[model samples]
Target: MKKYLHTGILIVILLLSGFLLWRHSVQTRVSHEVVRVADVGAIAWVPFQVGLEKGFFADEGLSISIVSVQTGDESLKALLSNSVDISLAGIIPYSFVALDHPEIQVLALNTFAKDNQIIARKDSGVSRPEDLIGKKIGYSKTTASDIGVEFFLKNHGITKGQVTLIPMKPFAMPVALATGEIDAYSSWEPNIINGKKLLDTRAILFNDVLSTYTWHGSLMANKTYIESHHSSVLAFLRAWKKSAQFTKDNPTEAIAIASAYTKIPAEALKQIWSRYDFVANPSPEEVVSILRTDLLWANLHRANPLATIPDPVTLLANINESKI
Candidate 1:
């Protein structure tokens, strides 16, 4: 009887040990949450790239796959079509569709900068703001660059009738100016940077008008995604916060990461890095104010004449600060 009792006790201990080991293994393993993000490969998105390269997202148990697009408008489109879980884009793009799709939310404002400029050809006699009066100004319509150009002309007392506004893709603006397809173009970096390089001594940049406006680069998601994946959204925001601090603390390393991700030269990124404010979250009031102004402009210029302008307050409600 004593021998039988000892054998039984030993068997029970062995089973318990196996169970404990299995439980430990399960507890220790991480199930990564996959997040698909659409981005317009801009320098403003450096923090996101930094977060990816530095393993910050991994720390949050997130596996991020980036979908590159050419413009913020395209980024928003990807999100709307459900092709991407999140989108990194500008305030202008979000504002354009905010009324139609009230479900889309701005998760955070990652970048705020006055980075747009009007690149003109000196040979075309655009030496100053007034010189742009009769010149053909190339700009990407329905984008932030459009607003920049409009504000620029307004600031310089140049009427739309005085100058011909030509619609062109942002990437093509520099080459168009170089080839004399347009006398001047309004765009942001690295297009602005490239235009100067292409024109060399002939390129002149006007930034004073753009400096009055601060452009916002934001992270956005749909209401359904936010509701279903609240924890994931919070995790992303936390990682972004860390990334922003890291970028500010380590400028050289951040520049290298951005340069690699954007394919822009490191020196050029470093030159404009100081201008970008990589804040993970901005005050809701400030965002609302900026959006209100932009919405007014869109109503007057971009929106359909019959479409009712959505109240900026309604748009402000979509700013998800709970995660921030």
Candidate 2:
């Protein structure tokens, strides 16, 4: 009887150990998990690019395919259309979409702040914000540049009406300013960087100097996808966090990755690289601040006055910060 009892106990223990091992294996086997990431091709997204080059995504049991869009809004549009799993774009643009699509979930705030400057040609004789009055100023409508210009003008008591606002493509702004088509242009990097190199221009004002949203690049996902692919989401964030850390620790390699990916010259990327703050996860308060600022910006620029402002709680409801 004693021998039979001991044999049964040993069998039970072995069975339990075998079950635990199987569970571990199954949890790690996140195969065929593909993440379609649509993002702007900028130095701010270097961490993700570095992750792809270093196999960080695969290490987390995910396969990621990146689609580089011309602008952040385009990337967000792709997300809204269900053409991509994740969208990496500016907070203000995200806010515009989120007001209508409350189903959007934010994963992480990847970058904070940029040097959106008002670049004026030296010969234009526009030395300060006040000089912009009655002069044609070029900017991409409703973008960071527009927001930056608005706040800068507000600081100097110059309204948009005071300036002959020329709506121009960002790439066209530098040339327009140089060739006397427009006296000045409000643009962000690498265009601004390129403009400086191609023309004798001076930056009169940067976004940081103004009372604007500043700008943050965030990673977002559709709510349905987040709900169903919880593990996958966590895995992606883990990989992203790793990449961000790697970038900080290895600036030279990070610069190279960003230059190659963005097609911005290495020197240009380096000059403005420090302007970007790459954070893998944002605090709840930070997320709320960004959302609130976006709402205010949209009210001013997007003509979305009737849009409901999202509170901090509602904004952070879907943010998964467990790993960070």
Task: Name the best candidate (by TM-score).
Answer: 1
CA displacement after TM-score superposition, residue 53 of candidate 1 (Å): 1.0
List runs of model 1 lying over 4 Å from the truth: 1-30, 209-212, 303-308, 311-324
Query: What's the lDDT for all of these models?
Result: 0.81, 0.75
lDDT tens digits, residue span 144-181, model 2: 76676776678879988899888877778777877889
**Which residue runs does candidate 2 get wrong by more than 4 Å?**
1-32, 200-213, 317-320
In model 1, how large is the Cα lDDT of residue 90? 87
In model 2, pairs of residues that clash are: none
